[model samples]
Every structure is written in C-alpha cells, then in structure tokens.
Target: MLRIHFAGEDIGRVRIAAGPVPAWEMLLSLHALRGPADHGVFGPWRARTLGVLDASARLLLRLAPPRGYSPDFLTPTADNDIDSLVDAVQSTARRRLRTDLGLLAAQRGPAVWMRPLADGDTTALRCVGTAMFRYHQRVLAPAWDRIHAVVMAERAARVADLLDGGVERMLSRLHPHIRWEAPVLSVTYPVRKELHLGGRGLLLVPSYFCWARPIALRDSGLDPVLVYPANRGLQRLVEPPDTSNGDSLAQLLGATRAAVLQEIGGAEGVTGTDLVRRLRISPASASEHATVLRRAGFIVSHRTANTVWHMPTPLGRAVLERDSGVRAGHGCQRSPARAGFTP
Candidate 1:
C-alpha cells in the first residue's frame, strides 16, 4: 500500500490539473504500449501505434519498461504543452540526468547505450528528445483532441468534487483502490511506499493512459503528484467510429440509462434532483441509472451533503457526439524525419 501523509495546510493546497501533462502522457503511454496485448480496451490502440513507430522509438522503450522504474528526468514537473516538454527533456540538467539514470541503472542494471545518457552527453539527450517528439507526433498527436477532451472531462468532474466536499471528499473518491482517512491517504500499489507532503500538498493529474492504479513520483522531494487513470478513455484514443453500431450507447445502456447519460452530458454539474425533476422519474430510478452510468465510466458523481452532481466522461460525450453527427474526423500525420539515434 502507498500511504501519503498530509499536513493540515496541505489539504488547502491540493489541486487538480486542468488538463493532461504531455510529457507524463508520453511516458505513461509508452508503458501501456509495452504491456500485454490482451488488454481489451488498449489492444487496438497498441496495434495502431506499434505499426507506425520508427526505430528511434525503441530508445524510449528501454528507458521505460512495461513494469518498474522510469527515469524521473524523462518527465519533469507538469508541462501541458508537448513542445515545452520536449524542450525540458532535451535541456535536463546534467546533474539531474546522472542522478536519475544512476537510479535506473541500480534497479535494472546498466545498458551500454544508456551509459552516454548517464554521463549527460548532449548528443544522447538530443536523440532522446527527437524520439519523444516523433512518438508524440506519430502516435499521440492525432488523437490529442480526443485525449484533451477526455482529460478535461475528468478534471471537470474532479473539480466539482473538490468544490462540493473539499479535499477529503475528493481524495476519498479518487478510486476504489484509494482511501482517504484524515491525515493519511492510502492507495493500492505494487510496492510498499509512504509519502509525507510537508505542506507541498499534492497535484492530482488525470491521465488517459495510467492503467489501473495511481502512480507517484519516485523522488518524493519533488513537487508531489498522483497520476490516476481518468476513467478508461482508451477506446476513444484507439477505436475508429463505426456507424454499424448505431445508437450504441442506448443499445448498451438501455433507453433509460442512455437518456440519463444524454441529460447529464447536456449540462455541467447536474444534480440528482435535477434528473428526478427533468426526467420525471422517481429518485430511486434516477439513482439506479446514474449508478449504472458511473460504473460504465460514462459519468462521475460528486456529492455535496444531500445533493449528488453527475458529469459525463469523455466516452459518454463521444457517444453522444457520434449520435448527433457532431464528432469530427482527424487524420494521422507522420513526424518530420530527423537525425536518427545510433548506438
């Protein structure tokens, strides 16, 4: 279990990122790509991404294994813009690079190619930056609009939770695996760990690529953040629109539940009372449909005292957009060729 100890003032300092962190998304998506192909949601995305990767993309795979430690310098403090993030990685301080690379070596043994990186060679850093930029342009950039929409939807839900019930309520509802009990917030993790936020608070970053559990920075001294999966937006990132499955949301969720999703998506921070009155349904029926939508990753519910607010997730919004003929098509573009990274 990972336990995060919070100071009294830390609660007030907690924040939810308004959008995705491009660098973190790049790194985390690499990890997802390297994972098992049996993933039902991400399998299609993996296949599409793998078909387009250039040789230099392998450099990133070595640094970020499917499971285990990834170098901290690869992902610096939260930067939403991909260009700025690539710049940050390329301009990483030599001392920081050595420290992070040394840690990676200690855990997974040193690699011949990584030796130059550990020594902070300028050429090595540039190659890494090039690979990152290519991967983003080729793999992530096409789907960025969808990715941003999903992440923002998650942020909207979380922000409503924070405003409705403050830090404790928001923390408590982050995930089923996460638990908030006053001064400490505990999370299910592969390894046992503890983080004490000595009034630095914590940044809650919503990620479309984070798998099942929340991940924290290995170096606790840095500004702390917990990147949690933003309610399974993988299908949006991977799958193409299929008109064959017409009104699929209604078909899968049933008429009433689909209606519930549509109504919730039409507005922001809709309360359960609003559903009851607008839909002309009993409170129990509204609650039941909302529960079904929440469980399906179509919506998130934030409660305030007696009121419960429901907001649509990206998946839900996409479904509605598709039905309404409002969804836009984006084309994939290859990254401009650059000098290759040679060992």
Candidate 2:
C-alpha cells in the first residue's frame, strides 16, 4: 500500500514500489516532439503538446525543490568540478522555468491546435530529440543535485502563477484542442522507488542516463526504469570526422551548413513560416544550406507547411564545439585565441 499526501503544496516523499520518472525526462519527451505528427494536425499539435509538457514540468518542479545549487558552478564540458557543474545546470534550468510561466500559459488549450503559437509542421518528437540533446548538455549535465535544499527551498508555484489569471479563458481556449479527461497519470514524482508495471517490477536510480524518459508506468506496465538520453555514447561519435585532417570534413560542413544547425536548434525547432522566422534567413538560403548539410552527414532538414527544420548530427555538436567550449581533442590546452582555454 502506498500513502500519498499533498500538504498545502508539498508532496511528501512518494515511495512507490517502483519509482517515478525523472521530471527532466518528461520535459525532454514533450520538448522532443513539440511539432506536428503524421496525422498532419497542423498548428494545434505542437501548441497543445507544449502546453501539456509545460504544465507537467511546472507540476514536477513544484515537487522537486531545487537542491544544492551554487552560483559558481561550471559547465559539465568544462574542466571544473563535475558535481558543481551538475548543480548549476539543474539550478539554472529550474530558475528559467520559474520565470517562464507566462510563456507556458501564453499558448494554452486544445483550441490552440487551430492556430498554435509554435508555427511549425515538423514532427514534435524529432524536435524534442534534438532539443533534449542540447538540454542535457546545456542544462542537465551541469545540474548536480548536491544542494537541493537551498536552490529549490521555496516550493515552485507553477500552478498558482499561471492558473491565477482565470481558468475560463485558458481552458476554453484549449478545450477544443485537447482531451483532459483521458487517464493522464503523469508519472513525474521525483522521489519514488520500486515501480511495478504490467506484470513486472523494475528499479529506478540516477546514472549517466537516469534522466531520460517518463513512461506511463501504469499504462505501459513496464515497471519503473531509468532511461538514458538517446545521444548516449554517440555524441562524440558525431564530430565532423575531423576532416580538418583533410578539407573533406569542411568540404561537407561549411559556415552555411553550421548556420542550419543553429537555426533548427534556435527556438528549439519550428516549421512552416515559423521555420523561416526562426532561421532568420530567406527560404532559398535555408534550403540551400540544409541541402548541403544533409548531403554532408551534418543535418536532417525536414519540411512541412512550406517550412524547413534542421536536426543536428553528433558531428553537429562537435562542429559547434569550437565555439561551445567542449574540449574534444588536444587535451584541453588553452590557446591564446581561446582566452580562457587554460589547461
């Protein structure tokens, strides 16, 4: 028997025989696919999905107070202490979420499908995938929960903050596009143990891949399990093959090619005219660069509603690394050009 309690806004440690998925996992999933699906639902899918995810994330942050975060924390790719980096990343992401409730609520409800604020025709899952890859590096890796008690001391008020403006407009706007009545047992409690699914039981814990996906434990019946992001051991493998050894690599990924990578990841991912808006380049320019990168094994540009989106290759991250501060080769030696690139 499991005992659950919500004191005011506090969720006492929820101890399940099987653990709940990490909050980050759910965020990543929704973010990964904030684009339209094959059904071609047009604008509504991305908007509604994001609204759902944004809603879910707010709920989770409330439960998992930010802990052990420090100001001077370094990025995971940096040589600074690993633990501090993690704390910083987690803390920063939480802070960003806290302040961005307005953006979340801005695009609410099921009717949002008729005209989603997202403006994309790309599949939401692909968008979420690339976004997660970046999110893990840019946010998750650096967030080590060493001092959770401090950063997230105040209970996150996502619901109160967004829900305050009157539910009538919000839900009514979304009512036409979404189905809230469905059994949505959002599996996002941060402190759960032992998850039983279907006829199986599984263990959940933190690890290199612990912050991956939040499965519907009850519906999927797969028991509780930790999921690793898909990039896994593949991130480094994607580097542009160091073709700098020859012009071969550059022959493939040029400045134009790199820009495509930036565009796709810019506002996470966009489609239709939104893609043009995000890339900030003309349709021809976007198409040409995308074509080149796709040929060179650097990007996967997809089109819908007359717009294009790019998904970076593992090599894409490396290509961006010269600017990213991720020490790949030459053993972290700081070049005078890199100012802070100390050994």
Candidate 3:
C-alpha cells in the first residue's frame, strides 16, 4: 500500500487536472499497447496505434514499462498543451534525465539506448522526445476531441464532489482502490511505498487510458502527481450514439424534453450549457426541461461551479431504447462539431 501523509496546507492545495497531459497519455497508451489483453476498452485504439508506429517511435516503449517506473521528465505536469510538454522533455536538465533514465534502465534492465542517454547525450534525449511527439500525433491526436470532452466532464464531476463534501469526500471517491483517512490517503499499490507530501500537496490527474489502478511518481522528491482511471462512462464518449429514437420519446416527453433526453442519452455528463448550445435553446428552457426529466427519474443533474451536468439514469436509457426501438450502442454518426468542446 502507498500511504500519502498530507499536511493541513495540502488539503487546500489539492487540485484536479483540467484535462489529460498529452505526453502522459502517450506514455500510458504505449504501455496499454504492450498488453492489449489487460485493457479491453482500448482494443480498437491499440490496433490503430500498432499499425502506425515505426522503429524509431517504438524505441519510446523502452521509456515506459508495462508495470513499474517511467521517466518523470517525459510527462511534465497536467498541462494539456502537447508542444509545451514536448519542449519540457527535450529541454530536461541533463542531470535529471540521467537520474530518471538510470532508474528506468535499472528497473527494466539496460537497453542499448540507455548508453547514450546515461552519457547525457542531447541528441539521444531529443530522439526520445521526437518519438514521444510522433507517437502522440499518431495515437492520441485523432481522439483528442472525444478525450478532452470526457476529461472535462470528469473534472466537472470531481469539482461537484469537492463542492458537495470538501476535499475529503472528493479524495475518498477518486477511485475504488484509494482510501482517504484524514491526514493520510492510502493507495493499494503494486509495491509497498509511502509518500510524505510535507505540505506541497498533490495534483490529481484523470486519464482516459490509465487502466485499472492509479499511478504516482516513483521519486517522491518531485512534485506529487496521482494519475487515476477516468470514469467508465467516458468510454461511451469515444463512440457517441449518432441518432436516438428521440422522435418517439419526444411525443411522450414534449419535443424539447425528448430532444434533451436524446442528447443526454447520446452523451452522459452533458452540461446544461452544452444542451443549450446543441439544441439552440435558451439556458432557462434547457434547465427547465432537465429539471422535469430529473423529477421524473429519467435523468439526474448535479450542479458544479454553477453549471449543472445532466446524465440519464438507467431507467431513462431504457425508456429511450424502448420507445425508439433502437437499442443502446446503435445511433447516428457524431457531428464534427460535437467532437470537440472547450474544457
């Protein structure tokens, strides 16, 4: 188990990443590609990425092991910008690169590439950075629109949790494997370890492809970061239902309410403003319809940062499926516009 000792200041300092870090996602996605059997959700993506990677890009696989230890410099922070992250990796301090690469080599056994890296070769380091950038463009850039939307929705949910019950509640519910016990947050890790925050606090990052368990930085001396799996519902965002039986449901619920339900059903965790924009209706109309749907138990809405996010309940999905005679997972294609959303 990994025990995280938190100071008082750390409580207020706790933060959620606004979106996925491109480099981090690339690293984890590469790890996922190594063992497709372990992560079924990413099966399609793994196949697609495998078909594109070249020998040079494949070299980056050495930087991340399927289990345990990845160089810290590869993933700078929670920043969503890929160029900035690539810049950080390329400009990493020679000593930091040597130390992190040495540790990675030690854990996974030395690779031929490590010789140049350990010698503080800038060209070798830039090669690794180039590989990471190429991998990101090939594997993650295409899906970034869907990825960003899901991540933003996740952030909205966590922000709601923070608002509802403060930091403790949010921390406790971060993942099934994590436990918050006031001053210390314990994580069931593959290896036994303890991290003392010493009031620097922790940055919680939600990753769409982080797999089953939460991951933390191996060297506690660096700023603390915890990358956890995003919600299961996020998987649906990857292949959003194109069309729903909204016409039939619209008859039962008014046209507007049915349209709202269809949109909520198509994508879970959609905000009222999102609905307003999609439906081309006023905010008040969207909120009113959503409230009625919530009262009828078709959907549930949670308010976070003054914005309300709506998601269909099982019954709501059932109602739409039954009414439309269109089963879940079968729908129209997603609009190009729906593919991206600002977080």
Better of 1 and 2 by lDDT: 1
Please provide, for model 2 over 1-343, each residue's C-alpha lDDT reduced to its tens digit, 9 standing for 90 to 100.
1111122222222112111123433233333343334322213333334443333243333222222111111111121233433343344433333323223333342233212213322342233334434433443433323111111111111112225543222212221111222111123344343332322332322222222332222212222332222221122211233432344345444665555666644533334354456657787766666556555554444332132334554445445655555455446764666565422
Task: Report the lDDT tens digits of candidate 3 across residue range 54-150.
Answer: 7777678877777878888877756778778877877778788789988887788877868887776889878887887787787788777656655
- TM-scores for the candidates: 0.76, 0.26, 0.73
**The best candidate in terms of lDDT:** 1
Preferred candidate (lDDT higher): 1 or 3: 1
The residue ranges of model 2 lying beyond 4 angstroms of the native Cα positions read: 1-255, 265-275, 278-285, 300-309, 323-343
Q: For residue 246, what is the lDDT in candidate 3?
A: 38
Each candidate's number of clashing pairs is 0, 39, 2
- lDDT (C-alpha) at residue 131 in model 1: 96
| Candidate 1 residue-wise lDDT at 22 | 85
Worst 10 residues of 1 by lDDT: 334-343
Please give the TM-score that candidate 3 achieves against the real structure: 0.73
Better of 2 and 3 by TM-score: 3
